[model samples]
Target: MRASVSTVQDLGMPAIYLHLLAELLNTIGVDERALLLRVGLDPARLKSTDLRVSQAQASEFVTRAIIESGEPGLGIMLARELKLPLHGALGTAVMSSRSLDEALELMTRYLTLRAPHLEVSRREEGDNVLFNVSCSMDLGPLQGFIMDAMLFGCVSMGTQLTGSPVPGAAILRRGPEPGYFHRFRQHIQVPVRYESREDALLIPRANLKLPVRFSDAQLSASSRAKCEEALKQLTEDAGFACRVRRVIETSHPFPPKLARVAATLFVSERTLKRRLQEENASFQNLVDHVRLERAGELLKNTGMNLSQIADVLGYADAANFTRAFKRWTGTSPSHYRSQALQPIKPQASSMRATA
Candidate 1:
């Protein structure tokens, strides 16, 4: 499904999902406290499943864990541990779905409750149905992990509901096979093709018609209604900020004017400002956030010079871009780029202080 532009904002993932990750980290002997701290997340705050963490925090934490644990398949490992209870009403609705197809539909519709950054849609190609997954924002290094978790989670959950491995199922991943490719055979029980053009799950159309063992019509209806209500509330509470941020991030020629953004959102400039204030954000702040993020990505990944980066970010000159970069990161763009590119060196004492 094509997610509405409103869903593109960086609202965050639910704490329950993070809780699962923390549990996985703890199980694997990783320092959960240290990991949370690295991402500026409070361990105490995650105790409540009702809370949410910013996408930046979530991505950083995942990246740190991946680096520290050396587990390239961390996402799949986490998905293996996930249970339906963690997903709230959406899980309930999925469990009560009459068939696998209905469950998939419910999952696609309510995925925002868990992974607001992703959009899932169904398409038919010949004899197979493809559940395509796309992201609304740039996930950067977290893309593979996130995609793995989502696709594996769906398959895992489908198995639970059907009491059988999903028949004629396969996975298509956009990136290369990870070092832990063996784990896919151990956990997925389905053919996985990496380095594909898209990230999707391929299921025979016949499997979509298979009945869910736990299907209950009345319960499914009630749970679905609850999901709808919860989704509506989530959208109202967090979507405006995300919408504004999405607009800023995707606008051509870099940051669009506040009035233009307001118009795109179909609200008056005054109302837009007021709504953003209510969400503890402002237009310029959002613009700066997008610019800084784009700037950092360009600086680290592209050979673009300062002036070119500035031009891409809508700045009149490299001087203005340097000033903004320093303001955002406490270092000039050139300095930041140099630091990022520098190779790590051992301390003299560790290197035997020889000479």
Candidate 2:
């Protein structure tokens, strides 16, 4: 089955994914809230079901979580926790869907709402249907984790939706098996093959007709409508500018050069500039946007000195950084830091009554 995907690459990822990761970390004695704060993510923001964290922040936080927890298999662990309801509208739609195939169709169409970096395609090989999962961007070291979560998450989804594992279903991976996977192998219900050409889920063709345990026609209709609107809005908002911003957000050496960014995106400098101009944006503006965002994160979250912060943000010296920060926010960096870091106060009326 071939489905058209209407989405932008790396636009943003649902906050629920990260929020769930935090919860999983907490179970293992990691201070999830402090970890989120250290990554410049406000702990309160993840509470919103509709909220999305930028790809850069998400990448950084996940990387840090894996490193700090020393759990390279965190992806599979997290997959184990992905209950249907936790997936928002997509989950609802899948739950209410008529059969396994119908739910997969919805996922193929609306996957961008959850993980914008991935796309799914379906193919038939003998008696099995392969759901090929591919990354649309260069995810760096994070690719393995993302792939694990996605492929295994599908296995989890099948078991939840069908009330049991789909008959004769298996998983395919592109690389050799990791040592850590041996620890989790006993718990996994489905067979997983490694060193394949791609990451995919293989299920018997007969399994597609397995009816969902809790199918509801009216609920499925409503949820699919919601998914459509979300897809439309996400596609409209994700333009060349958004892609450029993503590149800027994840680049190393603080701010990246234009040529480097263009090359990373597989475009020439002139084409990159022209595309941004079409979207009423410029390369420098996108860079500045990411720089200012990181600057604020560093100022509020870390105690780095002005010189250190300057160098981190690609400025020649503290003086230049101070000038740029003032220009961006109309306040000196020191003053802004004081204001941002200050504790909130109670209302004057409440204070007076207490007094």
Candidate 3:
């Protein structure tokens, strides 16, 4: 079916959890590239570490894939791929650990990088460590599902880290589903509040200082710096980043950048690039991000032909655009376009699950 660019403008950014969901889709025989286009992305460009995309794009793509493929909780279905001591094939890594605190610390550290939205915080009070969860605001829906996964992941990690039963530690937020609680609650027999101030777990603080089986001080420091930079950039200029991003909200290739964009901004290319760089951004990056951001909107709502969509992004040819998509998502243009034939659904709780 043909897609209409105008229609996709209404669809917003995707939720963070959806990216994990897309990874999960691979195990279930879903063509991830087709899924990319379904959410308005060209599967080729996902490789640029600096390139940015919106949560809406991820959500729209997965949602469309689910509807078209008739799959539910596509993210959960792919849990086997994760490396954290949570749900994947390697989950056994945390299953036998030296101490409970070390297990919690290791799982928290690993998962934070794997799941960007799941913010994990730790504080010490003598031997017990107080852990707080601050979810990424980028999460739209699917927050509940991710949250559920975290609960179990936490329990599993704690058990694995300590090599002992994870006690029913007190939790701050509303508890899990009755059946879920019943199945996983042996170690979690503590009290839970309906609406607590934060989503956190109270543990022995001494546990945090305990070294993990896998230690990488250098890598941890490097990751911390990168995350800090991303956060700083996103916090200070995300408005401008998002504003400039609207230029290419779909998977289409970027236009040769109108000499007129500078003219309209009342500056020279040299001047614009200089100013943007001063803010630590480049014009091309903004254009690419807008394309990724828009990709989600387009795939979820539009009916423009893939070729037409390519043209809208100002690509000279569909093939060039397809190559770019493959870089981003490991798929082609037409296939990504083909994935956008369904409606997106709402997520559970404005409170995200991953974080």
Candidate 4:
């Protein structure tokens, strides 16, 4: 089956970051709107604060942006523009944190909410504490761009939060230096080392005690709470089975074929099956779950008959739909609908009424 761009699920980087990237592309005369549209993304929709673009689409857009602008340092440039507040809840939490260490810890724990592909870990080396940056997946060609954004973005945000250059701070990159880094070297506050063992931000232990410019105990607590909720939702949605279920739920044709769904997600049939199996799920089960949920809604809320509901649910006929519904709920669809439609009576309280 040919992949349909419209069927791709939205479960990746925040749209606000993409909006920022678009603005950057425009400044460089790259026709950002066209570029986004070329990849099936709506330019206006990218402005939403709570929207997410599909990982496949985002990957394609960034790849194209790099090729079109002839600048491989786009991620580094984008990092310079990523102000703290622009990061949403995570940003607010970090800004209001009591100390630089607290802020880093907040980011380490909640980075998945903003960028699901990256993770931050801490290590001690002499007087410096290394906040290592690593990709949670195989990012392929985008590794350099993502690393530049994450590591450099951390450096920029650190300085912004503390209101000064962090003492004894530097960036360590794993591979030989990219030629593009030199272009932005003068603008960067800290020295950067290449051919290092890991991509990390090296900061002195003393720097961790530095006070944040916007520290607020109350706001930090509130913002951290929001970040916690966002992380939970992101983790739940990050599951392969959950992602497949979402695709099934939103599919236009209803109960899309396994082949088409695999295509839409940019994976082969075998790979999709394997991934779902790893999560102890099957495509048929996900589709059936969605069908059952929709069936309940239709049966209870709509006046449509069983045949109409069956057709809407991709069932061959009412008999098959009825049989399936019975197998699932141990009752006939008509009986369930009748029960759902019956008026409810308030039950008397178990406790005695007050005089």
Candidate 5:
């Protein structure tokens, strides 16, 4: 099944899914026990108020489950029943925004209200918008879940604004797994990038000025103060781009031109190019390298069809993706995956497993 969320409530931050998973698993009777055993996790860990499964532990656990089930879509399936709260003054502010842009700003400001470790911000990227996130905490078992929920949030907000999910979303994520890319793009119409600098959701610049029904000047005045007042007391200082990283860090196929991205940073693309050149990189090269890195991961793991893989990497079609993959590595996806499956290098960051 393509990525689909039926629940009306917003899927809260990543940990929300963990909590939901724990509860669901418990309700299912021994589901938690079974899920935990695959990762060598103790069942009691799920009982904690906020479970802290280390990255290593989570990687091992999810990897084992994927292999045993031979079902690459498990994480997304687990994600469907999650509910994100639309409560709070921030939620009210979001509901009250006059445009998707305003709603985005509301989300950017209020995201930290619930998840202190994650932050989101946006800036004009010329004819585009650049939403960004920066984070200090390791989400561990909740990483994918949290990231997926963020994507859902953005889509839902945009859909709410236009009364339908827009087909223009382009996602970027740095994770190498094909599963995430496929999982992401299967539902969202735009391209999904894997193994990119960060996760980002992009909409056209045209959507910036859209009029929202709830943007009444008086009501906005009333709600604006409430949001700002709450923001003032926020004890955490983690600012901007944590939520953005959730998408682009996995796949970065839908990259606009570096100059375009540079424009979003309020810098000339030429100047941006010059600065990146100073750093021994160019925007296109960075985007390509990220895509290649993600392609490598997708080829190595997951059983997704090659056409599906191509779609996720932002190719016009399978042939284009194949040619690019061969160009990048001088071999086919099949050959690459065959090579990648050998000995599966163990690493702290690489989420790996065998089926």
Candidate 6:
């Protein structure tokens, strides 16, 4: 999908991951320059892990890569190459953790710095620990690829930390099994079950206590502090509108009320409104913007009908959603989804040249 103006200004991905994708594409005989151009990304500006690109740009690039390379297992391939250092501070924190359990805890806490669209939670199921994965946004066609990379990347990184295979760790994918499922077994070296009820990792509790190969107490403390500080800076750098937009986009009930959003942000409603005004935005505008983007995503990527989409977006009915969607894009959801089946021409104007 072509990114809307608000989407270009709001959602983003870490540049490091983009760089890794570029490297992989380059190795596979894809022209990195041409690929970046297709997504309106600038290679020169992506030199640092501190930089970021719009989520629209990242998702579009992956979509194009899959089409161009004819590789449905691209995410799994990329996950195989993911080393701990590539994750920045979160990587360091994981590497320095006292044990695998602590490392997983740090990953749960700081994963958003790398992937803002995912939510990670840990629960105890008898003697096993379940690390559940949930998405905050509809990932469109990129859902399977992204999830594969993330879940497999977790396994790869865990192995790197403990310096051996993570015994009894198995993957549970909610979607249908891919034809190239062996790629997962090759990299993760563990049992994987697709068509499960949830996307999670079933980790044996005994393995959680395994000592990290690079366990450094002092470095772990320092790295965690750095991660916290960096997270604060990252939020501040996103500016007021983008920050509020993220909060709204990730809310569980879709478009949460202004007061609820304010509470989540730890500010009074009056203060939240005032800050938004300072940024030349309003809560309603951000809410509508998020709803419109999410509506477009679900329409394009999922089989959920208009009524289901309406319920997900907090609309009274499909009729109301249809009206709002037409107001946003001058087309009905059905027409939009039909058009989305066709390949979209890459637009240079869809992304900023520099973040």
Best by TM-score: 4
Task: Determine which window of 10 residues in candidate 5 has minimal summed lDDT.
Answer: 2-11
Q: What is the C-alpha local distance difference test score of candidate 5?
A: 0.53
Comparing 3 and 5 by lDDT, which wins?
A: 5
Q: What's the CA error at residue 114 for candidate 3, in Å?
A: 7.5
Number of clashes found in candidate 4 = 0
Candidate 1: C-alpha RMSD after superposition? 17.7
lDDT at 341, model 6: 41
Best of the two (2, 4) by TM-score: 4
The parts of candidate 6 lying over 4 Å away from their true place are 1-11, 240-355
Clashes per candidate (backbone, < 3 Å): 2, 0, 55, 0, 36, 0
lDDT of 1: 0.78
Off by over 4 Å in 4: 1-11, 239-264, 267-355
Deviation in Å, model 5, residue 56 alpha carbon: 15
lDDT of 3 by residue, 1-355 (tens): 3222222221222222344555566766777767775455545445333344554455456457656566544433433233353232123333333445544554565443345456688876665666777664534345544554565456445544444434545555554343334433443434445465566777655444454455445554554455455446544534433534532433433443535345423357777666666666677766654554444456555787667666766666667766655665555555655775233222223112120
Q: What does candidate 5's lDDT look like per residue over 21-51, in tens digits?
A: 5455455443555665544444433333322
lDDT of 1 at 236: 76
Rate residue 69 of model 3 by lDDT: 61
- lDDT by residue for model 4 over 109-174, one digit each (tens)? 998878877778999989889999987666677899999999899899999999988989999999
Quantify all predictions' global Cα lDDT against the true fold: 0.78, 0.82, 0.49, 0.82, 0.53, 0.78
Write one digit per residue (lDDT tens) for candidate 6, span 1-355. 4443334334367777877888898888888778776555556446466666656557778888988878888899899889998888989999999999999999899887888778899999899999999877667778899888998888888899988779999888997888877655655678889989899988999989999999999999999998999878776767766756655654445677787667545568998888888877788877877677777768887899999999989999999999877776666789989888443222233222121
Give the 10-residue window scoring lowest on summed lDDT in candidate 2.
346-355
lDDT of 5 at 243: 15
